[model samples]
Target chain A: MQAAADLGAAAPSRRTEILDGLKITLPFMVGAAPFGVIFGALATSQPLHLSPFETMALSLFVFSGSAQFVAIALMAVATPAWVIWLVTFILNLRHTLYAATLVGYVRHLSLGWRFILSAGLTDETFAAMEDRYRRLGVHRNSHWAYLASIIGMHVNWNCWTMIGIAVGMQMKGLDGLGLEFAAIATFIGMVVQKLRTAGAQTAAAVAGILAALLAALPYKAGLTIATLVAIAVAVIFERHLERRGQA
Target chain B: MSVGIVILGMALINLVLRCPLFLVANHIRIPGIIEKALAHCPVAVLTAIIVPFALHLDQAPDGSQWLNPDLFATIAAVAASLLTRNLMATIAIGLGVAVSLRYLAVF
Candidate 1:
């Protein structure tokens, strides 16, 4: 029973930890909010209609900005709803990688806990956690810290969506000032964080340029191809380096 | 038949592909090719996603346009991010550049 009390004390501390994590992650929302606002505004302009509730649900549940954008764009063209959803789903298939990484951290928790944590898993969260784990060896309690980071992010995202909806309703020019550039800033930060060696930076630059060359393919399939190619090239190079004891 | 199925199928395949990686983390000896691929996953994934958005904004001669708001904003944002490394400053500059250019009729 005393152990239970100790665990309870730890729980409140976890909440505090989560709060602190939010402070660290708040800037990510700067990018996220503009994406949401663009989504809300773009969806509003379309003839393919959704109730506000549906729009909210799409953002809340689907929770993918690019996929959501594509889905709405397709819907505006009278594409079947299933096709739009399917494409969005496929586009976001990468989230599974995020989920899988997180599973190792939280699979031992209760099913409900696992479900909740999995729902909150996202690219930023996954990257943040991956960087954390790589820097500090895995700990049993690391999931809690990662979860705290995500909780901070979750509040920022949802609240900003509400703000976007409000501003989208009343404003016309919010799309000005290139707020979407925030995503570029965010990506640069992510890339900088991921740079552990010269090889990684080379791989990133090659992939960035290659993906740009292939950006016009149908259904964005060109992107998938470019990514696979870049990965293949980098992997081969890294292995050669490793064999030479030069990595 | 529904797009949801596609979405769900993609999700399933992704999980299945990765499940082995996680479950076999200790048991299996991964091939060198796979190791190299894993090393580049961050770059590949980021490049794959960011590029399309960056180039989405382009201009048509007729006045109707697809402009690269992301690209323009990214340029400014990257500069700011590299300079300040302050999250707020980078995003603000990026967003400000994209939106201002957008509404200023600069195309």
Candidate 2:
């Protein structure tokens, strides 16, 4: 993973890291392709009846699948505009955590670069970029690689979404494909891979159980509550370890 | 039309939520204790998302939907994920199991 050394200055190895980023992101791009298409299809389908331009515009600007999906579902039921906005906000709280976790890695970056990276941070991009950072065991300035991954997905999402819109206009349905389950399984795989520590492992279990219990909470806020509870428990355990000089 | 405006609102609020942390990342310094928690953020957030939805309790005709296709497939996915450690493979396995079960008319 660490082919280039001497990060001497920001973006010096930009070309190489961008290529590395693209290569690392290839596998995820394949997995996400169908998801983008499905989203586009849903957007243009009868229930939502969104114009292709609206679908593309949302894809271009919003760039979040879950939020868009939730928004579409809400809008299909004629949910209030405020509720749609609120739901999208709650669904996106996880990005705040992604931002916090990336602080140590991107603190040295310029504001302009940070803006670009932040806009691009999603579940898949964060996973790919974070995997690379952990491997390098260094903190900052992989934005070139990070940038590559985000930009690649951005382009891919837009393209497939447009294609999906066209397909939706022609075809009737896609629900039977069980595509959403694939997304679920992907997250499960990511969670398993990152559960390296006992504390983290137990924290994940706590979060999962609590989230399942509170899944009926209004506006999907249970996710935020569950995430916060897990973080609190994990931090408490980490403090114990730190006190014992084992951290 | 009005829908366009609502979506614009979405884009605006979204960018506002997304931009600040990265923009201020250089200025703000997080303390050590919080950093430890942040390290586990991915696992927590991801698990929060997956578990509740994967085990969704929507009712069914023949008793609990716990016996439903999604949950049954998630069980298979979890087992496959633990063994494969590969995201793509896990997705394929889970989707395959769920689709197959659905085709067989399993709840």
Q: Which candidate wins on DockQ?
A: 2
True contacts kept of each: 0.38, 0.62
TM-score of chain A of each: 0.61, 0.68
Question: What fraction of native interface contacts is shared by candidate 2?
Answer: 0.62
Work out candidate 1's RMSD over C-alphas: 6.7
Q: What are the Cα lDDT values of the candidates?
A: 0.57, 0.74
lDDT of 1 by residue, B31-102 (tens): 546555665665665655565556651122122333655667777776776777765577677778777777
User: Per-residue error at A121 for model 1, in Å?
Assistant: 2.7
lDDT of 2 by residue, B57-103 (tens): 32221224555678878888888888988766777788899789888
Candidate 2 docks at the CAPRI level of acceptable
Question: In candidate 2, what are the lDDT values of residues A50-121, reduced to their tens digit?
Answer: 889999999999988767765665566455576567656655766776787676677676788888888888
Q: State the lDDT of candidate 1 residue by residue for A1-247, as single tens digits.
A: 1232344433435555466456445666565776676566555433433445556655666565555555555554344455454444444555655555555555445565565566666666666677665564444344567667667666666666666566555544443344434444555555555556766766777777776666544455555576667767776677677878963
DockQ of each: 0.32, 0.45
Span of 10 residues, lowest total lDDT, candidate 1 chain A: A1-10
Candidate 2 Cα outliers beyond 4 Å, as residue runs: A1-35, A38-54, A65-118, A121-151, A167-171, A174-179, A216-221, A241-247, B1-10, B21-27, B58-63
TM-score of each: 0.61, 0.67
